[model samples]
Target chain A: MRRLPVYLVLDVSGSMQGEPIEAVRQGVQLLISTLRKDPYALETAALSVILFDAKARQAVPLTELMAFQAPKIEAGSTTSLGAALELTKTCIEREVQKTTADAKGDWKPLVFIMTDGHPTDDWRRGLDVFRQAKTGLVIACGAGPDADTTVLKTITEAVVSLDTADSSTIGAFFKWVSASISTSSKKVDLTKADSSEINELPPPPPQINLVT
Target chain B: MTDQDSAQNALPRPVERAWTQLLEALRQAGVPSAEEGAYGFGGLPPEVRRVLTFIDRRWPGAYAASDSATKIEETDMPPAPADPPIVATEQPAVDAAEVTPDAAEGMSMAVSKQTILLKNARIDQPYQETIALEGVDELELIDDADTGLALDPEQDAAILKGLPRHSGDFLLRLRGWRADRPCEISAHLAVIPDPKSLWVSKESDREDPFWKPDAVFQRVEGELLCIGASKRGRAHAKDGLFRDDHVGVSVDAASGWHIAAVADGAGSARFSRRGSQIAVDSVIEHLPARLQTHVSPHLDALVAAYLSQAPDAEARLKGQLYRALAAAAFDAAKAIEAEAAAHDQTAAAFSTTLVVGVARKLEDGWFFAAFSVGDGGAAVFDLDAESLTTLSLPDSGEFAGQTRFLHKSEFVDYEAVAKRIFFAVRPSFTAMILMTDGITDAKFPTETLFAQHAQWFAFWRDDLAQAVEFSRANADLQAQLLAWLDFWSPGNHDDRTLAVLVP
Candidate 1:
């Protein structure tokens, strides 16, 4: 089956400690549970979780949606968005199969990076690598007022700003993500035209707006 | 009825006349036919039209046709390179390309004007052949049906195109003319089977349910006792999927040949579970006959030379055995490929790793040969020595969790494959165990663990031996082995397969 690999890069730093972290955790769980109900996502969506703080680690490797479990969110010292970006690239290279001349590989990955704070490390290098990726649709979300929308824009054209990191807003963002994933996963077909690229995502809720 | 008769017969009552008048009014209002104007873009408001136009321009396939058309023009119109005209061959056209000196050198075959003959060419490695064509213009290399490339005349002899990876009849049809007579020649090419290409998922119009039985076990008794079981991993079980590993055992009492095979289907491959099943079943079906025909004649001398430690004798024996085993593996790969083709799918959709072992009972001991294509563990537990000897070691790639699969197209190097074939003539070995990476990753994570953990094999030998002795039938023993295979570690979960042989 053609798989739509989805990676979630989340900021689990000191700033996102109590409520924000809890919201992220709950939101991710909700996203996974909702995706499980979608037959399309269950068959075609492979999910991975990357957590960035002082360092980045693949908390969950790319796994089919049926087998995927949301990783526990732990707040670390500082946001290492650069490390997270690098790790995501590595994960894509290793896990996602790129189309070749002889055989078709996996579909282009769908990546969502949610951050509530600016990177403490040099993130430009990671951004450059990500930009050079042959196949992926990256969406960066700035969670709350403290997030640097300017930096998020540099990372991806599809940037959204969440007004608050409250549970309701975070939950809405996740619900939108689940819906977008379900749409993309259902659209993918090996025999038809390429449906890997997401053209129109589900509109964000009132608390979330395009960071134009 | 004709249109005029139907129209004349429809003389309207008052309601019918009103309906006809309404239909005429709607037609006069410029209602477009569904086929001609389904979207009714003209009827949309100006603002909506402008927004739609903008969005349509950004749509994925909007520019695909134009872009591809331009690409086709560029590729198809390249000027033919200048080259001297070839002299026509009047000698009643030789049936096939003449074998060049390259054929004697190695796996290379050079053919001119005639069909290219490829015999036992390695499937795991890429092969290139020199085709000597005379008086041909505009040679087109057609790969399958959809893709074709024009060959450069100036560099005709030096051209090296990669051969097809799967085993089947491939055609290289030369459509250019010879002596301006419109002569066409087709080369019937054959690729020796390798493991099926890795399986990738395809979208279906209907829902394709992905589920299979979790585990399977089989036992066959003859000169040697063979017990094997394959179990689904915890991760797969949680996902409601079957085990991607399969095992098969075949024993020929008359020939004293005990054959056992195990295959691990690639987890990422969509239909690898089927691939693994096909591979194991094929090997068990084919290996015994292959050994008797190819290796039996030289077995006695080879074993005698091996026992005496004769120079080159062991190497010779190993080579012969390797070729036989490789041929068997290729047959298994071909079977899987054929199955995929029958299902209108590519061979890669059934990619798997294969390991097969053949052992013959001797007067005092057993003579065994084992071959493997990917990462798995095989060992002999010597009862007399109380030591475990590693046979076929796990071959890993550059990174962790990376290993070559039998289905990889680049796996055609038989010499490399030969090196991995393990052969031994031991006086007394209590048991032989072959396992997939699922068990090895948890129990023997590294080469060191494989060496240090003699107890692991000992546990299996003792438990299995007792089970075999106590159990009334093979089913009971199979159940015991299946339960034992469920041993789990904290994080490592993968499909497990184990085949054990006792003499």
Candidate 2:
């Protein structure tokens, strides 16, 4: 009767405007559709998305995937993966620390960050703060030709390089992502128990991107 | 086991009463979990489960990476940051003439029916794929057999990793053999070899490393077993008989767990033989102590710890080892990274693959966890997956048998991407089998060999006379799984090893 939590720390920086951000939106919906089909993921996984530009915006909070609604994709000025990073750090720290929440804190939640450009803010500082709280998996994906993605790679040890922003891959990549999640969830259940004694939470989602 | 089930149903009354009293007490003290079913049952059983979940929920940064085999429990993590070089690689233009609907549409269609055994896509089509979940949330989906991370054609080392989809080899589609059956299976699979030229030692007329019929596998009772089968493959004069490569472990009957591990050093690297010895010695030497030091003492954790830290998780694995090994494998990986550096060589300098296993015999039934890494593969015959098939762990999307980032590095950041992935794999399961790449390619889909319970039960109680006799007599089966370095592995004289343990 426990649930799995998933958060999206999306990069809505300046460079994501043209086709990149739109592809991300479509992918998000595809992810939801994929989860709805899996008996395990639907019952266990929850979704939340935060969009960051010069500042961070919460597209959605920690809502069940079944009840999730697609938020509007709004592009803004400057690439601030650092600010988005910091916002993500706070939101997750709060969610994990929330004692009043219904479900007992589940697996350290999975956080996926997608970005086109690099960080316009001081990345080192944000990274220092983020690394200190080791309760989650933070995977960053860099997209497009102009995005300065160098700084985002420093967030988590796992950084997936997405080659093109081609709208076609957006759906395929998400489907692949969903398939992997289903497989891991199945492996997790088979490997451990549902009683919560093993604490061997299934691995968080992988970071992926669209090649432009 | 049935009593345990009954115990699960009999909610704790006394503890529930105590919880009510405590909640009342906390009313004055300002605490919670006050009433309702939350307090409906509170006893050692429920409390134990509650405590475990609570600790995981409350502890920030306690969970380790999926790749690691341990948890980070209530420890102070040093301030470490990740910095993967974020240089932008120019996106190549898509060629319109070469467009295929599946490729352009991005939906992944099943290609190889041999998911049961190792198979490849078109040799010329660039067997690379990247697909996202159509609708899903968990991020664990990208590790599938088809997701290729390094499939670029121009890279130099990429070519060296292994042979590209062989032109003449038949392609097999991956099939799910255990959908409705038991989680365990016994299967027969062909051990594949690397098609590269360098996999073998040359000139003098001995067994060629690629073609050397070295690797082997078997099934006993309901259990799957692999051993140091091909001593003839290690016939080279340069390195002595690969006793380290020939290492093996066996599990006994008990609820407790057992483990075994073996590893091989890349022949091209200097001191690689020493590295191989160090890897094996580390597993044999440190396993007992690590088993005892770890709170639960799982068969899998012991092997994982030993493989990460040799002789000592304390003295040797200071930096890279810490990153490779979890800090909470009862001991921090950072504590021994220094020793790793001293013995370390570049990717080209020294490289070795690990073979490990974790096992347990529980009262409810029996449990075994085994896995392979790089090459040497481990087979698990469980009745769970299907009564008949033995499941082979799929390759980690290898270009061939070759892998990435095992090379020497200047920096030893505990959070390095390479270290986080190859090392520091969070302990997710209680039992496991780990092995070098050499053994994995040696297996072909052979479920018929291990699926019959009646046959397996006899094999379990049967003596070695029957078991060894069958294996030695089956020359056709044996040749199908020889070490590829002899037959074709990138080239042999490649070190091969395996370990199995049950507790």
Candidate 3:
């Protein structure tokens, strides 16, 4: 039950057009591919992908890693994370139901949110839902030049800002994520473990890094 | 902190002053803001009045909880996640005018005394569905257009009037079992001779994770049965050893004429996880009544019968749903095991053990049949026995020690599946348990785990009878059973699995 499922909320707005979008796509691909190869990950994990710009869409439902497929990122006009947030809550609500109370109800579920700009749609309710869930963990990442770090901070306890919004930094974050997942997957009940591994994760903007 | 003072002082502000106030209020309440000019809250009780006042100031003319807007200086409104204070001029918050229970009120509705009742039973959704009374006003079935998963409509977007901070997702209360559990049917169980692979996968390997069972399966709710797997593993992963074995309930939901099949991976097969996954998924997806009627109750014939279907189902799965998008999620999982082998990774993620249960609801009663391969065994509690007993089927060799793999193409025949199967004789008053080897070692010392849980649950149903409670009891059995592999099992460890069938 310690096997946690992750939800990735990615912003595919027009501002992330050329390389930014490509890096994101590559970043996701790298993370999943890395997870698939991990021993603990193969045994204790699953993934769900949600993409949004003007509207929100589910590229993949909650599924064990073997069945997960990285979706192609298509940049569009608006950045509507509100829809993505709403949908993410719904997805977790339903996915978690699939698990019984006796098992890993304590299994840690972490949400990795990556965005470039502020929500184009009303996102107030989405934040409320985030606060209400309290069941899972949320990590927000602000990318490129336009990302509003302030907005990202509002939604999560852990926030990260990236420079250039390129693959190197994105890939670095993913490698760290892969490590975290591998660590998290080792136990069905993650009680006491090394916090340094988790804390060492990419810090929020201004303090973000490109090297290991 | 006084509402009157905050409002009077708040009076001297720019036209967009309310926005700053909203953010300030949120921050004061430990609510972070998205922007500096974002909304803030002044001095309001965590109640509805304060939130309504804030909404009025932002939209000025839009949002209305009762009928229209009012500028009251009372701080009694609770905070909520709803439409942005500003109306959706160019950007609206999720279908804005949708009349969301004002932020301050929605939470209260989620947990209010207003009970949600599942309406009358129908064929498609025979199970009674929950209907929220005054608490929830509307429901939306937002299905992810992709994946084909139908989202629950009852909880989607609701409006609650006076929400309390204690509120969260609406507390769902299921009604009595209106219709029969989905895919109600009978099937004959076909467990190949053991002493072969299941009970003794270690004879095959010592360090591999695939050689042992890590999960258990149960049909707790809806048409889709549930599966939970775990192992204690390395010292660092000791917590992994704590699996939730509901003390054996999947084996107890038996009656006359119905068959429930559960399987565990050998932990040795690179694709054992898939083995168990495909075994369970295939049985649920395939295993028609006709097939159930074909297998004989006797274990030896069942093994012969189970073996014949192995190759066919595996090959067929590749072209059919069991392999493609519909590929049994478990089967796909098994493939990952194979991939691990190809790479010679330390995970040792290959072979898996298996256990299966087949149950049917008949005119007489619920009939159940089961099969256990690898290290695990099967048990049943007959009212006549007074306690749970092993349904000792045909084991090819010693029950005292580990064994070898029997069927050559087991992947195909897992679901009692074969062009030709021998139907089993119906048993009366039965409780059965099918499990992996780790269970036999130190976990299920009582050995009578099947009867123990059956009796305990029977006491529960006869005593404090709550269906959900009963379900939890069963899930716990699975968790505990799987945990044994993670903890007590020696060596690097192996897979552990157990399935219970009751009649």
Candidate 4:
């Protein structure tokens, strides 16, 4: 079976403590609940979560939508976005299937990175490692005014900036994420083609502005 | 009550009657431990006292020790307890206060028996629910962001103004007011999935460089009934993609020869649809003529050599049929290569899987021969013989999801091409079936299941027979087969092509 693997790299730093972190929690919940209703996403799309604060860890591995359980997220210390990216690449290497002489592998994995503050560590090294891995669309979301779109643009061409990290705005971002996943899954299943760029995704919501 | 009633009888009638009424009201109001002293009697809340007063007026002398207690006339009662509108009904069964143990003094605000406002509401459908609450003057429904529902106080219901975006169990939190007291109650609303949302048909662009119909069906009734259909899968149709599968069939009554070709275009190839089209067409154009000129005159000799079990004669007959099918497959592979060259595209871009079956009636039975490339299957089902003869070997890899396609390399060696050809003889058979991976993977699922007779029997009897009415003739049979191609299998959406030759 050709599975559509999705990786969610979140920054659970100290700056995201109050409403922003709570909204992020709801945002993840919203994404799961929304995708569960879509038959195409439910059948093909698998989700994995990577969280970074003082340290980075895989909160949830690649799991089918039906059996997936949303993990409890909390705000910790530093913004270890670099560690999260490295961990995401490592997880992809361990989890995603590759095409070989014996069998055809899964569709290219989609990576979504969300951060409220600039990375506290050296993200360049992690970016270099991530670039070497084969992936589909890597969309970076910068939450609130503190989030830097210029820094996110270096990571991927598909970057979206959120006006605020409040519940409603973060909620809209997750909703757009669900729509984008649905579109990508439908695209590969129908055309047998991978979605590599941002134009293939649905238009982002008002709260989320696409960064060129 | 037997001991308590007698003990209570020892007290003075007026004090006992007053005390009994107070105690009964306190218990009904759920106020624990009210003493007989002045401070205890004065300690009762105003609402509880009002309820006791109302109860005394409504059911006079009911809780009194003596009949004379009815002298506390209605004139002394405060004008009428009208604020809460707790209409303690004559029938206890329908009383709202009796229904809820926590009625909060005189407030009888209780949710009605309809605890579930909505059951299995479908996504993107309009829904409206009116809740019944007793002793409630005004009701307010909390807005649930996910459900997309709003409170319509004028309509006195929770109206799903727009289509519901999500499907799940939603709790509708409602707050109703009985005078100053606020009562909160929740009702369950369940939303079911709408399967049709999973499939959306977009119109294919005819202006594209490589364009084909979304679906195709063909039927030819001669010595044999040949019905074949190819349909764009849900996945392809959703994005307005071309049908990457094709079927070509020919049945000649004069020559007593019938041939059916089914091909599946590689999904990754840009022009594989054209490749599949050229493949099936090349076989229909070349194979039937070759069988007519070469095999027709030797029919009697071949049948005699087979029945007599003469090795030399039988090998000669087998060689003729094998060469015919193989040559046809080779021609198909060559034509695809030429077309790819003309379009300035790689031959691999025109990759496809092809399965062809040729049948000729003889004195003993029907002689069936087939040549195959790639993963689809071709088989002859013989009900009388209680056997299923698989005519072609699948070119699937060691694991699933990989299949070999028709290419020049596959047919370059004469011996290799001959290995792909198989022959069988059956006096009477049910049907000759040729299908692409779309149909085979969904119906057969596993190789073990595909190789079993019982699976094939169940597939034919329970699935195919129930779906298509083979007894129907001509156009009707073609329509049924084309419609039957729309059968759903989870994680198995692909371009489907099927050919069935029934005697």
Maximum-DockQ candidate = 4
List lDDT for all candidates, in order: 0.67, 0.41, 0.45, 0.75
What lDDT tens digits, residue by residue, belong to model 4 across residues B1-503?
Answer: 65644543353333233445545555676655434222332345444444445444334444443434223344434333132222221122223123333322223333232333443356788866555566554454543446876555356443334466787767766555443344555665656566556677987889987798988888887767888889998878877888889998898777888999999999879899999999999999999777877678886787777778877875676578666777788889999999999999988999998999988787867888888998888888876677998877866755335677888888677777777888777888888899988888677755666677777888888888778877535446767777889997766678899888888
Best by lDDT: 4
Error of model 3, residue B430, in angstroms? 19
Q: After superposition, how far is residue A2 of candidate 3 from its true place, in Å?
A: 6.7
- Candidates sorted by DockQ, best first: 4, 2, 3, 1
Error of 1 at B63 (Å): 92
Judge candidate 2 at residue A29 and give its lDDT.
63
Per-residue accuracy of model 2 over A9-55 as CA lDDT, tens digit each: 77777667767777787787667656655545654566778888888
Candidate 2 structure quality by residue, lDDT tens digits, B253-294: 332435455555553344444444454445544543443444
Comparing candidate 2 with candidate 3, which one achieves the higher DockQ? Answer: 2
Q: Under CAPRI classification, how is model 3 graded?
A: incorrect
Per-residue CA lDDT of candidate 1, range B78-164, in tens? 232221111111110110112233322221112235444322233445665565666554444533321122344457453535544
DockQ list for all candidates: 0.01, 0.03, 0.02, 0.13
Task: Give residue B311's lDDT in candidate 3 (0 to 100).
Answer: 53
**Candidate 3: clashing residue pairs, number:** 148
Off by over 4 Å in 2: A97-104, A193-212, B1-503
What is the docking quality class of candidate 1? Answer: incorrect
